[model samples]
Target: MSNLLAKLISMKYKGKSNIKEYIMEISNLASKMKTLKLELGEDLLMHLVLISLPAHFRQFKVSYNTQKDKWSLYELISHCVQEEERLWRDISESTHLSSTSQNKKRKKTKGAAEGSFQQKKPKKDEEFTCCFCKKSGHMKKECPKYATWRVKKGLLVEPTAK
Candidate 1:
């Protein structure tokens, strides 16, 4: 999937880059994995996406869909498309086996009615930013990204935020 994502990202849509820029670009892959829910770590993500480029492209959404009961990425997408087509066709009978599935479809027919459950809600977590580094991980005041070469007045500043 990481390889596929790289192919997608690099599909001539991302413009251009160089060696140093690519290195720094690779460093932020961890955040990309977390945000994209790719279920991959930083180093491996970079290796697959950056290094493994063309060869693994076909692994993007290959096989996996067993009638014995199993699903793969491609299978899942095909199943979704089939279900959508069925809905579009307005089938009188459902193609799925689940009884609960029929119940939901019935409810969508209007005025069938249903009950909702009440439950305790968890408290939200507080979000914080670094004061020293003025960044998320480190403090704003101590941010290394803010450092400048040949310091002055025991202080340094970054020319640009990016």
Candidate 2:
């Protein structure tokens, strides 16, 4: 009986389980203490629950301690449960905001990649050769063969010397 009571007193809260479940577990231990002819009042039960809570609830414990308001077991449970919900809500909201921003960034990067898919412009220093005359020094525009062909086809008139 003493060992069970000690176990109840020493139990610590693990974050993996829900706060409500933890509270229920503590309540059961307190009930067992009562059956064993031990005195386990609501106030003591509340104290045990508060102390057994994880370090995440440090702020909650501090606020509860500083205030003049004396909360019963039911009121404490309600407040703790609300605090748990608020903590998770804030976490989920921040995660959602970050994911949305990441998606927007991904879309912008994809758009930039698509724009770059077009053919790249040739650099200024790079020279092109004439395909018509098979020459390396000049382009098709300045090729003699092309000039003669254009003149014969009447596409361009011969220039007269000044």
| Candidate 1 colliding pairs | 131-140, 132-139, 132-140, 132-141, 132-142, 133-139, 133-140, 133-141, 134-139, 134-140
- Across 13-83, the per-residue lDDT of candidate 2 in tens digits comes to 88788888888888888888788898788888889999998888899999999989889877887999998
Candidate 1 Cα misplacement greater than 4 A, ranges:
1-16, 49-162
Question: Ten residues in a row with the worst lDDT in model 2?
Answer: 115-124
Q: Encode model 1's per-residue lDDT on 129-157: one tens digit a residue.
A: 55544556444455654553225545554
Global CA lDDT computed for model 1: 0.44
lDDT of each: 0.44, 0.86
Residue 114 lDDT, candidate 2, scale 0-100: 92
On the 0 to 100 scale, the lDDT of residue 1 in model 2 is: 79
